[model samples]
Target: MRILLVLFLLAVGCAGRDDGEGVSTQRERDSVVGASNLPGASGVRGALRAADSANARHGRLDSAGP
Candidate 1:
C-alpha cells in the first residue's frame, strides 16, 4: 500500500515537470532576428519614429492647459 502511494506521487510529480527543451527552435530564432530588423520593432528608433508620425498626424496635444 505504501509503495503504491509513493509511486503514484512520483508519477504525479514527474508529470507536472516539463523538460523545457522546445523553447528556441530554428524558425523561431530566425523570426526573432528578422523582427529586430523591421522598421517598427519596439526599439528606441522604432518608438521615436512612431511618436513622430503620431505627432505629425494629430499634432501635439496640450495636456497641461486648455
Candidate 2:
C-alpha cells in the first residue's frame, strides 16, 4: 500500500541521517583531553604530547643523537 511505502521511505530517510550524538566538537573534545587526570588517553593531541614526553624521557628525541 502507499501508506506502508511512505512509512518505509520515512524510516529509511531517518535512519540515513546522523544526529551527531556520539561525536564531540573540538572544544568539548579539548576540554576532556586537556584534563590531565586521564592517563594515556588516545586523543590525537594527548597522544602526541605523551609521545613527546616519553621520547624526551628516554633521550630518544635529542638533537645530539640517541
Best by TM-score: 2
lDDT of 1 by residue, 1-66 (tens): 999999999998888656598678754555575468666445645555676688776654544457
Q: lDDT for model 1, on a 0 to 1 scale?
A: 0.66
Which 10 successive residues of model 1 have the least lDDT summed? 39-48
lDDT of 2 by residue, 24-46 (tens): 77756766776656755557566
Task: Please list the residue runs of candidate 1 whose C-alpha ends up more than 4 Å from where it truly belongs after superposition.
Answer: 1-42, 60-66
- By TM-score, how accurate is candidate 2? 0.27
For model 2, what is the error of residue 39's alpha carbon versus the real structure, in angstroms, after optimal superposition?
A: 19
- Per-prediction TM-score to the true structure, in the order listed: 0.26, 0.27
